[model samples]
Target: MTLLRDLPLSALRALAAAARTGGLTRAAEELGVTPGAVGHQLRQLEDRLGVKLVRREGNGIVLTRIAEAALPDIDRGFDALASGLRRLRFERRADTFTIAADPSFSSLWLAPRLGNVRAALGKLDVRIVVSIALDSMLEEGIDLAISYRYSSARDLASADLFTERVIPACAPTLIRNRSDRDGVEMLDRLPLLHIDQTMGDDVYPTWANWFTAAGRKRKNIDHGPRFPLTVLAAQAAVSGMGALLASELVLRQHLDSGQLVEIARDVPALTIKRRLVWPVDGPKARRASAVAMALAAVARAEADGLRSAVS
Candidate 1:
């Protein structure tokens, strides 16, 4: 009628140590405790079990007959516990993957397609770190990074994810009555939302840059509410605040959902290369390569879909 929950784990450990080491002093040394403490734990265990578990035999101690009979199973149980702990740690490391990306890409692109990534990765748990700096990859233990900047370092492998494309877009309500004007004129009329120019790799185009690409001149190009992240600017555009020079790749959900509509189809889209990078020498390199392939495939498929839709 003794319940396993009522048994003290310390006492069980002391018993195992004593049985394995053959003496209380040696057991105490193995357990990193005093011999007196080990003896006390054994006494507690014996009292709880209503049995004489150990006996003094000259200068050393010996397990009693009943204790000796139980020692093998006890040793097996301890071994199983240690083995289980090791397996748990190993499985945790095996199943978890860490990736780094910029906040805008992480929020607008990668965050939405994670389910696809998960399916591609099987049971691995993907951890996304919001960062664009490749320098911190080793220090932060990042398994892979999706970044706009590519590195030619000998120790790293890089694969192109996709070229980020940006187009001018805004809520339908913002352009509801402006049907008479062309895309460029409509963009000229609407307030221009801006993502902070200094934030990313200067790849994100500004309203001025978009106008130049369109061969038009507009004043006060920087005269809109500025956001530090592209995702934030996309949200502002969705709220009918202003026309956003939005990343077509990153903010596709908003455009697909009709939360935002492209105002300038004739204007040339701006583009920046985004790539996947990972250490070639690490234990996770193979897994990272597999994940990189999956991510690139997903991006390519989506990009193809977008192109098809646009055409």
Candidate 2:
């Protein structure tokens, strides 16, 4: 007879992640553990069971028959254990919250307001996962999400967060040299910086879009050095590498501080809307509501502050 009490949760989790992700390296990345550690745990589990769970292939791993046979039951057991743990922890801690959001917004906006949340709750932990992929809240164990999307979530309770508004921006020195230049003229003189495609569909208002919106054309829309993210692209523009189209929300502080200056401020703005989403039922809903309230308060405060500063 085998004892279920002898199984380690970490070893079981490693197996499931490896099975789901198709590799140990990917599982390690998602679990925030070393690949060696996950591999070790997998090997330990196989040793305890006296079975070969996986085998090394050419630069990859293949699951053995035993692993396949054992995993479905292991996954079910993990799910049940997770549900019980969540309920117990929720009942005990009662106030800590976790959220999932876009990386840029989480870093640039929400992080600054955590002090406010901490003050309100007395003690709270807000875990934020920043990825472009829209995660399943229940599956991923996230309480709330801030995502850019065209339609509101009817399946989940949701609220409007904010729209993205983009404008051409560059170092103040570049702006000072040609303060009177329009969008087309500025593009002629400056290296038109392009954002690398890593941000997926969310990164828009490209130079092409901006030029089209302005009823002008620029041949270098697809040209110039590409950066991996807005943070890097914006940094390049701030250093006078070239002109950049950045969200007014993200660049407001820079604009206010004179680090980056907008070109053709009168041109029509380009915008994309975003929203807050959460499950409609369960304890997650209460946690989601609390987070939403905090987010709304913070966003409103930021908007008001920026509006006043701009005025």
Best by TM-score: 2
Q: Write the per-residue lDDT of candidate 2 for residues 171-191, one digit (tens) a residue.
A: 877764554444457666678
Q: lDDT score, residue 78, model 1? A: 76
In model 1, which runs have C-alpha deviations exceeding 4 angstroms?
Answer: 1-95, 115-124, 176-181, 197-201, 303-311
Write the residue-wise lDDT of candidate 1 on 42-121 in tens digits.
99888888999999888888889899898888778879988898778666666678888878778767888887777556
TM-score of 2: 0.66
Error of 2 at 239 (Å): 1.4
**Candidate 1 CA-lDDT value:** 0.80
